[model samples]
Target chain A: MWELIRANKRNSIVLMVIMASVLLVLGFVIGMVFFGQEGGFFGLMIATTIWLVLTLISFSSGDQILLSASRAQPITHEVHPQLFNVVEEMKIAAGLPAMPKIYIINDPAPNAFATGRNPQNASVAVTAGLLARLNRDELQGVIAHEISHIVHRDILFVTLAGIMLGSIVLLSQVFLRGMFYSSMGGSRRRYSSGGKGGGQAQIVMLVIAIIAAILAPIMAQLLYFALSRRREYLADAGAARLTRYPEGLASALEKIAGDPSPQLATVNKVTAPMYIVNPFKKAKQIKLSNLTSTHPPISERIKILRNLSQGASFNEYSDAYANVTHKKTIVPVAALSTKEDVPLRQASAEAGSEERLDKQMRQVGDIIRRVNQFIFLTCACGLKLKIPPNYKSNKINCPRCNKSLDIPRK
Target chain B: MGTSILIVFLILVGIPLLLILFVIGIYNALVRLRNQVDNAWSQIDVQLKRRHDLIPNLVETAKGYMKHERGTFEAITQARSQAMGAKTVSEAAKAEGALGEALSKFMLVVENYPDLKANQNFLAVQEELTGTENKIAFARQSYNDQVLFFNNKIQMFPSNIIAGMFGFTKRDFFEIEVAAEREVPKVSFS
Candidate 1:
C-alpha cells in the first residue's frame, strides 16, 4: 500500500507539472495572437503569476471554505464525547500530529466527508442519520475508508482536478466571448485579400481553438472521476487493512446503499465523487451503469468484499473489478445479513490476545498490592521495622527496640 | 499578414481559455477533497464523544456493587479524568489507552461480583458501552478515509503544487498504533 501511494505521489507531481506547462503554453499562444510575441510572453508570465496566487489562497483557506459551505457546526467534547473519542482513537492509530476538529451536519442522510488542506487542519463532518443508523464495526469501516484516502493523498488529485475543470470552463467562456466579438468585424474588408490558403488556415485554427475549449473541461472531468473511482476502491481495501475486517466496511456500505436519502443539498457533480457513497439518488432497483457513475457499482463492491472475507487478496479484488464489468447480481437481503453482522464470539476471539495481556497486567497489580500488604512490620517502640528475607545475613532495624527483628515475604 | 493573423489568433485566443479552465478544475477538486476530510473527522468525533459519555454511566453503575474494589474504581476514575483532560491526539490516545486498561480492570472486578454484572443498570451501561465502541470503530474508519483524501491531495502532483503554494500539507491519519490499547477484558474463560 505504501509503495502504491509513493508511486501515486510521483505520478501526481508529474501530472501537475505537465498541467502547468500546458496552461502556460496556452497562455503564451493567446498572448502572441492578440498582442505579438512580446505581448504573448508577458501574458504567459501574468497567467502563471495569477495561478500561483490562486493556488496559495486555495491551499490556506480551502478547509474553512468547505466547512462553511457544508454548514457543519463545530462540536466540543462536551457536546459529542463519543465522536471526540473516536477521532482521538483514529488520530493515534493513524499517527496524526494533531486532532482534526469535528463537526456535525443536521441532514438526515447517512453520509460523512472530511475536509481540510492537510492532517493538522483537517475536519470531518457527518450527517445525523449516520449516527442513528450504523453499528460500531460498520462505522469503523467507514471512518477507516476516509482515512485511507487521506493517507494515499487522493485529496490532492481531486483538488487539482477541480481547479483544472474550473479553469477550463472559464477559458471556454472567454473564447466564446472573443468569437462573438471577432464575428462583428465588417464583411466589406475583402475575405479574399488574405489569400485562399491563409484564410483556410485561419478558419482551421479557430475551429481547433473552439474545439479545444469545449473538450478540455470534459476531458478533465473524465480524468477527475476516473481518479475518484480508483481512490474509492483503494480506500475500501485500505480500510479493511486498517480495521483488519472487511466485513465492517462492507456492512457500512450496505447500510449507505440501502438508505434512500437524496444527496446533501450542498453537493454537486464536482463534489459528489469525494463522498464514501455517491450522495445522489437514482431510481430504486435500477442498476447503475459503470460508464456514467462516479463510484464503482455498489453490488460489485459488496461482492469484492465478500470475496475478501473468503480470503481473496486485493490484487484479485482489483482484477475482478477490472474483468467483471457486467451489471451486478443483486445478492438477497439475507446474504447481506450473513456478511453484515460479525458474531460476538468471533470478535472476542479476535480480541482474545489483548484481553489475556490485560488479565496478566491486572494479576501483576494484584501481586504488588498483596506484597505491599505483608512486607512491613511494626516495632514495639512505635517505629516501623525493616528486615531482609535472610535475617541472619542482614541486620533488621527497629529505632525504638534497638534490636534486630525478623520479617517474612508476603 | 494573413499568416501572421492566423498565428496571432492561435497565440492570442487559444491558450488563456485553457488556463482558465484548468484553474477552475483545480479549485473545484480542492473544494471536494477538503469536504471529504471534514466529513471523515466528524464521523470520528461523534463516535469518540459517544464513548466518552458512556464512561460516566458505566462507572456510576459499577460503583454500587464493587464497593470493596476502591482501587479499581479509583483507577477508572483517574483514567477517565486523564482521558478527558487530554488535549492533543497523542495525549488523548495515551489517556484513552490508560482508560481502557482501567475499564478492563473494573470489568474484571465486576466478574467476581456476579451481582454487579447482573444488575439492570450495569448491563444497560455495558450494552451502551459496547454499542459506543462499535460506533467509535466506524467513526475512526470514516475519519481515516478523509485523512487519506486530504493527505493524498497535499502529496500528489498538480494538486500538490496548489497544495504547497497554499500551504496545504498532508494530514496524519488518526490511528491506533497498538492493538493492545483497544483491549477490553474477555473474562469469560469459557
Candidate 2:
C-alpha cells in the first residue's frame, strides 16, 4: 500500500505539472493575441502564480468542497448504529488511524465515494439510495472499498488531481466561450484588418489559443482517466480481503450499475471519479484512448471479485485480478498483504425470504430516517409531529392541540 | 570537454548516493514491518479486552431469568478472570479459548429460559458479545497474518539481509488449542 501511495503521488505530481504547463502555454498564446509578443512572459508568470495558489488551497480543503458540493450531511453513531458498526469493523480490519467521518447524500442514486488527504482526515460519503438498496454484507463490501482508497492514499492524489482537472476544465470552458462571443462580435476581422503589428501574428496566436482552449481540458481529463484502472481493482481486492466475501461486493456492483435511475443530482464531471460506481448513468464501456477508462468496467471488477479461489487475501486477490484483467502483479511485492485467505461465507438458508428483504429495507429506511433527523414527538392530542434534524427552534406549537412542545438539541 | 568532465563528476557522486538511499530505504521498511506487527497485536489485545468487558453485562442480563445456571455463570466468570490475568500471547489464546467455551456453554444453558431470549437488553448484549467474538477472531487472524508477513520479510532475500544486520527475530503466533477450535477444518482445499 505504501508503494501504491508513492506511485500514485508520483502520478498526481506528473499530472499537475502537465496541467500547469498546458495552462501556461494557453496563457502565452492568448497573451500574444491580446497584448503582442511581450505579454507571453507576463502570462506565464500569472499562470504559475494561479496554479501554485490553487494547488495549495485545493490540497488543504478539497475534501470539504467536495462534501458540500454533493450536499452531503454529516452522520453520527446515533443516526445509524449499524452503519457505524460496519465502518468500525472495517477500520479495525484495515488498522486505520481514525474512523473516516461518514456522510450521506440525500440523492437516491446508490453510489458511494471516499475523499481526504489521508486516513486520519478521510471521510466517506454514500447516497441514501445505497443504504436503501444494499444488504448488510454488501454495505460492508462497499465501505471496505472506500476504506481501501483511504489506506492506499488514493484519496489524496485523486482529490488533488481532481482540483487541477476542474481548473483546466473551467479555464477551457471560459476561454472557449470568450472566443465564441468574440468571433460573433467580429473580432476575427479585428485581428486581420487592424491593430498594427498584431495583424498576422495576432491571427496565428488566436488560432493557437482556440486550439489550446479546445484541447487542454481533454488532455487533462485523459490524464485523470488514465490514472490506473489498477487502483480501482486494487481497492476491490482490498474490499474483498477486508470482508472475506467477494460476492457481497460483486452483487453490490451489479445492483449499483444496473439501477435504472438518472444521474446523481449533485454529481458533475469533476466529482464523478470519486464514486465507487460513476454517479452519472453512462454506459460502462466508454473507452477514450483505447488503453484506459475512468474506472475499469463494473462487470470486470465484479468478475475479478467473484474469481477469488482460495479466499479474499491479497495474494488470492492478485491471482484473481491477474486472471480476469490478464495483467501480472499490479500490486507491489512489498505491499502485498498475503494472509491465509478464508473461504467465502456460505449463503444463508432460504427461509423468511420476504421477511428478510422487508427487514433489510426497513433497516435501511430506519437508518436513513434516523440520519435524516426526523424527531418524534407525540402530542397529548395524539398528533405526531415530525421535525427535521436541522430544525433549530426551541419550541413548536402542535397543530392539533395548540400545545407548545419544547424541542431539545440533538 | 566541460560537459564530459561534469558527467564523470555526476556519476562519481550519484552512484554512492543511490546506494546509500537504497540501504536506508530497506532499513526503514524493516522498521515499518516490525511496527506493523506490534500494531496488529494491539488490535487483538483491544478486541479481547472488549470481549472481557462485555461478559459481565451478558451474565448480569441473563441472571434474572437463568436462575439455575449458576455453575455455567461461575465457569464463565472464572474464565474471564483467567483471561484478564493472562500476560503472554499463548496464555491469552488459551485463556480466551476457555472463556469462549464457557460463554457458549452458558448460552446453551440460557436457551432453556425462553424469557431471557426475549429480554431486549439481553438480546442486545448477546448480539454485541457475538460481534466482539467475531472481531476477536478476525483480529487474531490478522495479527497472525501480520506476524507471518514480518517473518517472511525477515526470511526473504534482500530484507533478510537487513534483518540479520539489525537483529530482528521471528515472533510467535497466538496458537489456540481447544476441541471446537481444532475442528474448524482447513479452508484451503487446494
Candidate 3:
C-alpha cells in the first residue's frame, strides 16, 4: 500500500510538472503574439497567478463547493445508519485516520465520488438512487472505492492537475475570444504600422500562438484524463483489496452503468471527472480507446473486477486486469510484490433482501423529506405521516386512523 | 599528501554518518509499523466491544417473542460474557467464535417466530448486529494484514538486522480459533 501511494505521488508530480510546462509555454507564446516579446513574461506571470489562486480556492473549499453544487445534504448517522456504517467499515479497512463526512445527493443517478485534499478531510457523497438500488455489499464496495481515492490522495492530485487544466483552458479561451473581437476591428492597421521584418516575425508568432491556444487545452486534458483513467483502475484495485470481494464492486458497477436515469443535473465538466463513472457519457457506447473520457469504460472495469477469481490482493487484481484487457498490468510492481494473499469472504446475509421497488422509492423519498426538514409522525395505525415544513394546519387528521394529532412545535 | 588526508578523513566520518542515518530510518519504520499494528488491534477491540454491547439488546429484543427459547438466550448470554472477559488476542478470538455460534443458533431459531422478525425494534437490532459483525470481520482482516506486514518487515533481510538491534518484537494475529466462525454468522434479517 505504501509502495502504491509512493508511486501515485511520483506520477502526480511528473504529470503536474508536464501540465505546468504546457501552461507556461502557452502563456509565453500567447503573450508574445499579443503584447510583443516583453509580454511573454507578463503572460507567464498571469498564468502562474491564475493557477495559484484557483489551486488555493480548491484546496480550501473544493469539497464544500462540490457538495453544495450537487445539492447534497449532510446526513447524520440516524438518517441512514447503513451508509454511515459502510463508510466506517471502509474507513477501518483502508486504515484511514478519520471517518470521512458523508453526504447524500438528491439526484436519482446511482453514482458517488470522494473529495478533499487528504484522508482526514475527505467527504464521500452518494446519490439517493445509489442507496435505493444497491444492497449492503454493493454499497460497501462503492464506499471502499471512494475511500481508496482518499487514501491514495487521488483527490489532491486531481484538484491540482484540474486547476492547471482550468487555467490553460481559461487563458486560451480568453485569447481566442479576444482575437475574434480584435480581428473584426482590423488587425491590419497595426501590421502596417510595424517595420516589415518585425511585422513578419509578429505574424509568425501570432500563427504559433493561435495554434498553441487551440492545442494546449486539448493536450492538457488528454494528459489529465489519462492520469484520471489510470487512477480509476488503481482505485478499483484498491477497492477490491480493501473489500476482499471483487464481485461486489463488479455488480455495483453493472447496476450503476445500467441505470437509465437522466444525467445528473449538477454535473458539469469541472466536476464530472471526479465521479465514479463519467457522468456525461453512457457506459454502453463508450469505447476503451476514447482519449478524453475521464473514466475507463464501465464494461471493461466490470470485466476486470469480475475476472478476479484468484483473490482480492493487488497482484490478483493486476492479473485479472491483464487477463481481461489483454494489456500490461496497471498496478505498480512494488504494490504487487508485497501484497499478501487476500481470500474473499462470503456475501453478507442481507444480500438477499431485495426490497420492493416502491418500498425502496418510499425509503429514498423519506430520506429526501428528512433532509428538507419535514416532520415525521407515526400514526397509531402504523402509517407514517410526513408533514412538509410549510404544512399550514396545526391539527391534521391521520388519513388511516382519522385521529387528530397536533403538530409538535420546535 | 594533504588531499590524501582529507579523503581519508571524509571516508571515515561520512561512512559512519550515513550508516547511522540508515539505521535511524529503518528503526523509525519499524516503530511506525509497530504502532500501526497496535492501532489496528485497538480498532478490532472497539468493534468487539460494540458487538458485545449490541448482543444483550439483541437477546432482549428477541426474548419477548422467543419465550420458549431460554436455552438459546442463555447460551448467547454466556458466550457474550466469555467474550467480554477475554484477555488476549487468541482468547478473544476463541470467545468471540463461541459467541458467534451462539448468535447464529439464535438466528436460526428466530425463523420460527415471524412476528419477532417483523418487529421494528428487532429488525433495527438485527441491522446493528449485522453491521457490527461486518465491522468485526473487516477489522480483524485489517489487523491481521497489519500484523503480517509488520512481521514480514521484522523478519526480512537488512531491516531484520535493524529490528534485532532495536528490540522490535513480532505481533500476533487476531485469528479465529474455530473454523466455523471464520465464515461470519450470516445475520440476515430477511
RMSD of every prediction: 21.7, 5.3, 2.6
Candidate 2 C-alpha error for residue B78, in Å: 4.4
Docking outcome class, model 1: incorrect
Q: What is the i-RMS of every prediction?
A: 6.6, 1.9, 0.8
Clashing pairs in 2: none
Which candidate's TM-score is highest? 3
Off by over 4 Å in 2: A186-198, A260-262, A283-293, A325-352, A376-410, B1-27, B61-78, B101-127, B157-166, B182-190
TM-score of each: 0.57, 0.82, 0.95
Q: Score candidate 3 by DockQ.
A: 0.73
- Residue A86 local lDDT, model 1: 56
Docking band of candidate 2? acceptable
Model 1 CA RMSD to the hidden true structure, in angstroms: 21.7
Interface RMSD of 3: 0.8
DockQ value for model 1: 0.03
DockQ ranking from best to worst? 3, 2, 1
